[model samples]
Every structure is written in structure tokens, then in C-alpha cells.
Target: MSDEFTDFHLEAGHAANGPYALDVDPQRAGWGYSSLRILDLPPGGHHSFATGDSEWIVLPLSGGCTVVAGTGTGTDTDGTFELTGRESVFSGVTDFAYVPRDTQVRIASGAGGRFALTGARCERRLPARYGPASAVPVELRGTGNCSRQVNNFGAAGTFACDRLIAVEVLTPGGNWSSYPPHKHDECRPGQESELEEIYYYEIAAAHGKEGVGYQRVTPSGHGRGTDVLAEVRSGDAVLIPDGWHGPSIATPGHAMYYLNVMAGPGETREWLICDHPDHGWIRDTWPDQPVDPRLPLYEAPAGDAR
Candidate 1:
């Protein structure tokens, strides 16, 4: 790949910084709003940081943790939440905690696990709160080979945030998710919203073998163009500054999961996208086809409100 594409693709361990196993901020991504960090803690380990100017959500990739949000003065406390995380990304929907901007946040895990700190620099500082796993809307999207499961825990309308919009997607092995390439690089009133996005991937292994997948991003001929075709593995990430990104395909025998973190300069925190015209017709075919049987790898926990 060329230097430009290579710059957007971060292999596992290439983006690690300090206590995070993978860290990508607006400054490092050459974008203005979105950021993501993956923290892997051993048993009985803890980590803390200040959420300066940006709102954040502590979503677990694996394992559970207790999150405490407080003022940096070491006196006043904002909130304390306990997350009942899952065994792994493919296991089930997990609860999370959100901390507002300009606060000090600490995370501690009794048994140790991996957590994702998805963030966005925004204008308002919302209150810190806990999100229950039962409240998340589990959606099965697309059909046949395009089938996938979506955990809309932090989607635009599902959960409220100032600017950050995050969600998780799972594609069964030999299937594709994020298909029919789309872009949100322009703020076109009711048509589309401009947003920068980050895709953090985790492919499930089988019998001591590592899994793999593919990601593609194409230029939209507007603003600063972005293009990439990356072979992704666990702990890898792709930064989409502006492009029609999609067709995230999982090779046979390995499931694929990705956490999508998005934010932008638009006045509204919406996820409206303009699909690639040539492939947009694919959506019309989904209505007549049967959804892949492997979909909904797991469902929302029992007693889900939605």
C-alpha cells in the first residue's frame, strides 16, 4: 500500500501508548472529533485518566470493571458505576459507563479484562451515567451473505450524547458487514451528516488459530480524500477521515466484530450517510432474501426493555 493508506491503517501494537494497548486521538488521526483507546488490564489492575474537553464511554471488550468519575480536585465525586461486562465481544451485549468532559475517571477490574474508551471532543459536558445491557437495542441487519448483528447501545437515537455516536457490529464467518459502501463526509441538511469514524476490530479465534478480515475505504472526490484497503486482525483499527467505507468481510471459519466510534462538526449528532450509488441497490434486494442463519450471534440479556 501507499504511504497515505498505510497512515490510516494501524496494525496491532503499532498504536499503543502508555497504558492503552491501542490509542487514536483526533490529533494523531489527522481528524477533528473522534478518538478511541483500548485498555487491557490484568487481574486486579486499574487505570485512571482525565477526560479533558471530550466526553467518553467505557465499553468493555472483555471482562467487567468499576468506573468512577470525579472532579480532579480529589474531593467531589460525579458518579460511580459498575459494568457487568461479557466474556468476549462475541459473547453478548455488555453494560457500559459514560463520563462527561473535564472530569477525572478511574477504571478498576477485579478479575481483569479489556475495555474500550470511545471518545469525542464536544461542546457540552453531559452527566456521567450507567447504561444497562438490557436497554440496548439489538438489531439484525442485511440479508444472506450481508447479514450481521448490531448492538446499538450508543447509536444516535438509542442513547444520548453530545457528539459521540458508537455501536458494535458482528459478522459471522464468511459473511460481510458494512456492505454497500457509504459516506457521511458532507453535511447536506436532511440528506447526510459529516462525521469522522474509527473502526476497532476483534476477530474471534478457533482452535488456537488467529482470525482475519478485510476493510476497504474509497475516496468521495470531496474534501481531503481518504482511501484504504486493509487486512485487519484482532486489536487493529482503521481511521476513516472521509470516504465510502464498507464491505468489511470475514474470512471463512472466523467471526468478526468491530466497534464503530464516530463524531463530527455538524450541529446534529446523527448518522446519516450517502451510499455509493452503484451499490446502493443492494439494499433493495435484502427485503426478498432470507437473513443468514448465523445472525444475532447473541441477543440482549433477558428482560430487555426494547
Candidate 2:
């Protein structure tokens, strides 16, 4: 809605299909990076992309596919990357990897699948390559309340990059994530890290029915700010530049999945959020409760499209 980003609402899938969509030109959304889109695909069908000014990440949302990433800056021999999309990876959910700008990347599905992808202009300039495996792994620290796998961009300095740090989180149904209502929009080393953030979502289907998820971000009113409390199904996204956000409330029907893409002017991408001073005491309560039983590590038959 601002000059910072270019908006694309995108078309939704059929009720028989799953809720899946792609987001691009994050800067238009006030994001410092660029993005791409993903949905359903037919066998032998392929998508080719020319990297813009910023780098991009090429991840598969669902079903596996083959990709060729290279410096094919107008030529065909730059080289290609062959990857097998996850067999059980929900076909229309989750993200892949960060794609560097100016590179030529191509993707072809083995049997045609669906996916959700985001491409951001890379501030941390670096050379483009195919299948550059260099994301540092970090596990969620809290209890069963929510567990996730984080790609520590700050730790994995494999490429000379800047302006963005990305992380992927998976939450089981009924389980709560983004607990404690934390915010990392302000950069304050060891105290409060600052950075504008965006939440890109992909919820897994359950028992032949679609799954649902929600996210909330509210401003503290130190000045003129905004608050967002949205019911986000798969493919939908919410932007959060400044505020106290948390309790990524999930429904009891099914588990959820989402990818968080964040970036700020500062050099570090570490997250630092100040909780609602009144609710700051909740972090202590997590150790006592059991995570929601509906959360899914892997559910099949798929739910309805969001």
C-alpha cells in the first residue's frame, strides 16, 4: 500500500486444493527485500526467474521439484542445481532458501506440485551460486509449547550479505508459538534487537480438511502506530514494522506452519522484542503446561484450502 512495496493479491486454489499463494517485491510492502510466488504446477511445467537488484531465496512449498540456479546471466551454461523436493513435504506449504539477485534460476516439478516462495533484494551483496548449502541450524529453545528449526543468517555468514535475515518455524496444531509476545523491530544489542519483520504463512491440511492460523501485532502508542490481528490461512501474509506481537494463536482443528522474513538497517538480524509489560509474566507458565495435542508433525488427507 506504500511506495516501499508492490502489491499482488494473487488468485486462490480450489476448495478441493489447498490454500497456497506467493508474495513478491517485499520492499513494496515496506520490506527491504524482494520475493516470489508459488501454488500448483503441472508435470514438465517449469518456472524461470531473473533475479532483480536484490538476491532471492528459492524454496519449495510442497511436492518436490528440480531446480537449476546459476550465473546464467543471459547464457545457458552457467550450471544447474538438481534438488528433489521433499516427498512428504506438504505440496503447498513452507519456504525454500534465500536467492541472490541477478542470478538466473529455473524450477521444474517431477510430477507437478504446489509451493509458496519469497524473493528479497539482498542488501548483503554476494556472488550467486547453485545450491549453496550454508544455513546455520538453530533449534527452538522453549518446551513442547512450540518447537522449530531456525536458519541463523547471522551465524551462517557463508556469503557476504546484508539487509535481511530469514528464519523458518513449524508449529503443531493447538500448540502456541511466538509466545511471550516478543518484538524485534528495534535494534539494541543484547537488550533489544531492531528490525522490521514480515510473516509469510503456510498451514498444513488435516483429516481431509483445511487448517487455519492467526497472528497479531499491536503498537504501543508511543506515537502514531497500527495494530494487526488477522486470521491468516495458507498463502496470506501480514506485515509488522513496529509493535508488540505474540501468541500466534492457532485453532484446535489443525497444526500450522509459517516462515518469518525480517530485515532492518542495523548490521545484526538478531530478534529483540519487548513483551506487553503486563503479560511478560507468562513465559514462566510455559514450563508447567503440555503443548496442544492437535499440533501435527505430519498430517495427511489434507484439509480444505484457506
Candidate 3:
């Protein structure tokens, strides 16, 4: 399946006055048929909803929020998990998913907080988190940029989870990250493989200016030179149903971050990519290289970039 890309502009406080507007559907974006939204809640207000699809996930990018998630099969409602704020989440620093055919859920913000939501359909439900026994954390560090961590979830779990696998990549500087293009659209026999994917981005800028960045994804193979370039900022998203994606280029002015959620029909969810033969080896050469010194991970109190 090939992916599609579309740009959206969401006003910070323009939510409809009803329960909740279906908002923006990313599935319609020509990717894996998913939906995403950045929801704003009034202080002490509550938003409770269910997904029409078999799976869904709710993530908090800023502020605090309380969530109640259950098996959806139980009647008593107490058989649920309660998560408060980003620090208390079981998955990504500010993200988590709710799976299975139908799961009833509710979320509320205490004072100020917004959520970056991403969901996709799947044959089965993948566990919320993986590893802990003896999982090693790999950190990618750069200047002005702090370190980003990757917990080999699928690797440490020994592939016990479902088809939907994930990894956590954090960025601290307004730096160009996720560089060195890679792809996984085709499955190789035993050694290399591919999987269609969608990237859900989350970012936070300083007090004034809005955070800004760009992403590039291109197809691999001879004569397949199509490419996609998207300028994505907070609440903006891009999809990669099939192609090599990289260099989530962040403006060298503010600190930003994003989470890459991916899954496919393939048996394994490992992060495997067939590089552009032209630059595939760059990944092997970055061990001794230094991150670009011009990148700015933290944003100035000034307004967002135009």
C-alpha cells in the first residue's frame, strides 16, 4: 500500500461546542486509513469518546490529563487502568494506545493540556508496552540537543507481541533528526524485510513561537524517484504507507519531538530498512560523527516561526 500526505491547519482553541467533532481523519490522508487530531479541553472539562475502528490511542503532548481505559468486556468498570499526566504513562512519554474491536474510554484535563491522537485498524491488539527484564536502552545524543532513547521493545520481548511494533525516538534540539533515509515496503526472505508505515508527530515549542519542522520520504528501487516533502509543525502529521522516510528536519530555532507509530500485516515489527544504496551506509558511519552544531533544540520565548 502506498501512503499519502496532506497538510492541515488547526487553530489552538477552535474546537466545536459539542461532545467532540470527529475532527481530522488522517486515514483519509491516503495512508493506512487512520485518523488523528489535536484536541483542546477547557479547564476542568471532560471529553469521553469511543473509536469506530478496532483500535485507537490517546497521547498527551502538554499539560496534564487523566484517562480511564478498560477491557470493554467487563461491566464493573473498575477493571481499568488510570493514567495521569505524561510522567505516569505506561508507554511513550506522552502517548498510549487502546486496542481490540471496541474499547470504552474517557479522558479529562485538569487545568491545561492537549492531546495528539493517532489510531489505526489491526487484526489483533498489541500490548501497551514491552521489555523490562533485561532490555538495553540505546541513546542518541547531540549538541544543544539532549539524548533520545530507543527501547528495543520487540527485541527484548522476543517477538511475543502482535503485528503492531514500536520504538521511542526522542529529540531535544530544534535539530534535524530521523535522518539517513530508510525503507521497509518489501519483505526480504529471512534477512531483510519491509512494512508500510505512518508517522505520528508530537512537538512542543517554547512559550512564544510555534514549533516547526519538515519531513522527507521517498521510494526505493531503480527509476522510482518519487519524493514527498512536508513542512510539519505542532498538530501537523505526515504518512508513509510505502517509502524511505528520514531527516524529520526541525527548524534550527526551537526544541521539538515526535513519536513514530508503525505497523503492518508482516509477521515481525522490527525496524528494518533497505537504504537508498547511495546513502545506506551512512547509518554505519554516524558512530563517530557529531550532530550539526547549528541545531537549536529549545525554542525561544518568541512567537512560532512563520
Best by TM-score: 1
Where is model 2 poorest over a 10-residue stretch in terms of lDDT? 8-17
Task: Give the 10-residue window scoring lowest on summed lDDT in candidate 1.
Answer: 1-10
**What lDDT would each prediction earn against the true structure?**
0.92, 0.56, 0.50
Ranking by TM-score: 1, 2, 3
Clashing pairs in 1: none
Off by over 4 Å in 2: 1-20, 34-36, 71-79, 88-98, 129-138, 144-161, 222-224, 287-306
Supply every candidate's count of residue pairs whose N, Cα or C atoms clash at under 3 angstroms.
0, 43, 13
Q: Any runs in candidate 1 off by more than 4 Å, and if so which? A: 1-6, 72-77, 304-306
Quick one: RMSD of model 3? 7.9
Q: Give one digit per residue, the lDDT tens place, for model 2 in 239-287.
A: 6667777767667756666666665556664556677787778778768
Q: Could you tell me the C-alpha RMSD of candidate 2 in Å? A: 6.8
Q: Return the TM-score for each candidate structure.
A: 0.95, 0.74, 0.68
Candidates arranged by lDDT, highest first: 1, 2, 3
Residue 106's lDDT within candidate 1 is 94
| Cα error, candidate 3, residue 105 (Å) | 1.7
Model 3: how far residue 5 lies from native, Å:
7.0
